[model samples]
Target: MLRRNFIAARDLEAELEQWQERIDIIRHKLKFIRQLPGVACIEQLNPPGTAGGRIPALVEIAGGTAIASEENGLLFPPDIVILMLPGKSIEESLREIGSLLEQPWFAESPALKNNRIYVTDCREYFQLPGPGMIDSLEILAEIINAGDFHFGFEGLGWIKFESGSPKNG
Candidate 1:
């Protein structure tokens, strides 16, 4: 009986891993998501001694004129990385927008976490133009799972969301 339980547990873990990979693929295929323009991607260098706060990378919005101050990083949950942009991306503009936006956090976090790219992708929309976006960090903290991911925008740049449950957007 104990042996059977062990096998079951191992299989469950494997299944979860497969699900995570599948979710990652789906996220990558998102036409709107991959093309988001991150203004800046701030990287939190893991030093020998320092109290790590949040957001490993900082971003600057392209054409949006938004900047991320360290104070803003403190506002988010430690686990989440926020991607900020000054403006929103229409489906037609996704490709161009993705090119304009930077993604330092997106690049660095995956390496830090052994290529768990999608999880890093679903950070904050830092410079998004909304009072609610800033205030929403706490709420995002609850909804974002350890391995899930998402993004959203609003107003001129108010879009936003989080990632979870391997499904199409």
Candidate 2:
């Protein structure tokens, strides 16, 4: 009985269709990355007032090299940095983002030096295993790919990190 229910829940046909769509999108995205070298990115977060640390496996499916891994390996400076914030509230999240940007080490990181740091709500985008994964992939592709793409916050659940300014939720 359990096996039968599990099989039903699998929704094999829908899963296959989704997989096919993802493959097609990947093929299309790969064209743009063909001439470009792989980008190095790191996922991290700064809580209210402490030093920031790496977020594990956040970018594994994002098609870039993740400088921070779960093994506590030496971190390499990244080309792109994604900062995830705890979803306390919009105002608190913004404050934490500002705190992170103000850190001297953060300013010195390669991502910040190159203005590649992006801020997002961790819960909606990174904390859960859900359909948001697709949006996360798309967001990473837009940032890493060579194109004039700007990060937005409607359905993507993310926004560009701009220091000294508050992002209206």
* Clash count of each predicted structure: 34, 0
Candidate 2 at 154: error in angstroms? 6.0
For candidate 1, lDDT tens digit of each residue in 1-169?
A: 4554355888878876765554444334433433332222222322111122232221111111112335323222122233322232323233333432233333333222331111122233333333333333322322222223333323233223222223222
C-alpha lDDT (0 to 100) for residue 88 of candidate 2: 38
Model 2 scores a C-alpha lDDT of 0.49
Instruction: Report lDDT (Cα) of residue 156, candidate 1.
Output: 33
Q: What is the lDDT of residue 25 in candidate 1?
A: 47
TM-score of 2: 0.60
Q: lDDT tens digits, residues 73-166, model 2?
A: 2145456655555543334465656555654455555566656666556566644444455555556655555253334543355555654433
